[model samples]
Target: TPTAVASTIKAKNYIKTITYDNSQEDFVEKWLDQVFSEALQIRSDNKFTDEVPQRYEVPIIGFDCLKSATTLIFMNLKSNKYEIIDRPGPRSCPIHIIVKSTENSIHLKFIDAKNYVSADMELDDFLRDIGKVEPCESLIKESWLLLSAIDNRIKDYTDYHIDLLQNASLAKLSCLKKYAYCYKNFNISSCYNPEDKANPFDLSMRYWKSKVNSYNEQDKRKKRRIDHNITYDDYQHFHDVFLTQRCHMCQARFTYNNKPTLDRIVNEKSHTKINVLPCCPYCNNLPMTISNQEVYDSLRNDMRNIKISDCAIRKPYLRIASQLNQKRRDVNAQHHYKWLTLQQIIQNMDYIHVTDDDTDSLCLAIAH
Candidate 1:
């Protein structure tokens, strides 16, 4: 790895040197032309500074040119910097980096993570910061959870911190187990099995196609162009997310009640890789008229009443499901009250006339 990085740096330096040489020659020629035109003599100091700037050979670590497509962990020896790139999406590669400024301090800024944690902060402070970020707070959490799994001290902070730590750890354990293939020889085709009906990739493809057909039919009826331009590779990435077994929207484990549904994060967007995420059916069914921010805001509001738990359904998810259950109960209660009121009104009435046209509607109301 060092040799490869050295060769790469050497090639880059050589090209830079050639360009610098050409530019310097041009400048010297121009200077000489001016000097001769004015009859001037060149002068220079005999002494040259002996001090030489230190140079560090770049040491590329834990990075494979091909295998590191998903994640890249490497160090720049010259800058003494560490970087972690997570480009899990299919259509684009968003960069994530960790910069070290002092021996005891590091600054982390990750777009996918959506938050930064300073190494100098106390454990409590870090937890406090993590609590502020809602929904898919950290890709770095996977690494931190793995560390906590190995070393218990990292998670032995406080009750609240431990709850958050365990939530993330369990998410990592439940979701990341699917990535068992050898990265160096990983074949995307291996994820799919034509004969296996239970295969997630196949299931996702079927679901994606059904949705595409459904949407296209609706759009055609409305005289709008079919906008679902999602590719097979994009759907495959959605399946990879499904293999995580957690809802990307609410971080809930996939269960019978809460099956995985591939959905657009923003309803206005097409089913592209970056726009799509694996969420539960309930979240998938959220009103399309709502803006992405409004949808998340509603979920966040529902999440406020829930506390972090060790269950497969975490706080943010359970709250929404519970809210649905509560709404169903409320509807039932309202129907029962209306039915009783109708019965009382009928009992108080004298002979009433019933027409054939109103009979079916009346029976349906009575049944409810």
Candidate 2:
């Protein structure tokens, strides 16, 4: 035989399991290579000696590794069993790796054997400790994004509720879904319900009202002085002329001491005679007026000049004016006959000629 070449392959006694604490990187690699080479040598006697077949293209399981860690796991590719290589690392090591196996899968976990302190734990560290498992990072990031969106949506709904409460408008309650969808990812089970007795938004609204009432009370307290010199005659006259009377301009009755200011009085230019009509606050502020005769003359002239095309515009005006005239006639009849109802005097007679637009403008004036 030729000079015998000592094979890089080691003998059967070559250590199948190696453990090292505080081992240099090169030494660890060399040790692993030798173990693998020895394993290969042991199987060489079989017919498959020319081909070293791998059971899996990649390691079936992979996780973090630290020097001096004990308990390595080796897979017997052919047997589909894990060999728990105990006494795997040197003594006085900070970390250990443990391997446990169920029927079909190998589980690896890192154990911190020593009580040595490390840097503050980070997300990455936690991830590494758990091993590079699939889909974990992506799942965490998606969850966080959803949480942030929900938080912002809740804040928006809260602000919207406050605005609606302040304005005393219930119209937007119909759009609860539009507002709620902002928190769609959070699975919030309910939307804002102002009528719900236990709702925090409703409770907060009540609290706000109470605070406002307190502030109003304080303001009243600060302005408590009365002007005693103001004469009853003047007060009574003003009350009669403005407060107790109906606004001649828009025909709204006022019961409060504060009547609509002259600036807000609409249709004030429609009054005429100084003596024929009382100089109510509204009439006194008129820009122009038609005397009784002038009104009759105007009505008669307009009727005479009416054209077919003008009928469209004139018809509405005439209809409303006729209703107003009828109301006036009825009032005069009641006053003349001394048969006016107390209710009519107190609530003011219903004047159906008043258009909705006129009614709204009159209400605003009365509110002042």
Best candidate (score: lDDT): 1
lDDT tens per residue, model 1, 205-308 = 77767765665565467565455455454666655666665655445555544567666655555544566667766545533332344433333332212332
Output the number of the TM-score-best candidate: 1
What C-alpha lDDT values do all the predictions have?
Answer: 0.33, 0.29
lDDT, candidate 2, 1-368, per-residue tens: 11111112223454223333223443333444443434444443322322322121111111122332332322212233333333334553433444333343333333331111133543354334322322243433423332233234335446433221111112333233233343234221222211212211111334334533543454346552223212223333433454344444344443322133222122322111121222223223322322344332333332211222322222221012111223333343223112211111111111112212322122100000
- Report each candidate's C-alpha RMSD, comma-separated, in the order given: 27.6, 34.5
- Stretches off by above 4 angstroms in model 2 are 1-139, 155-228, 241-368
TM-score of each: 0.25, 0.15
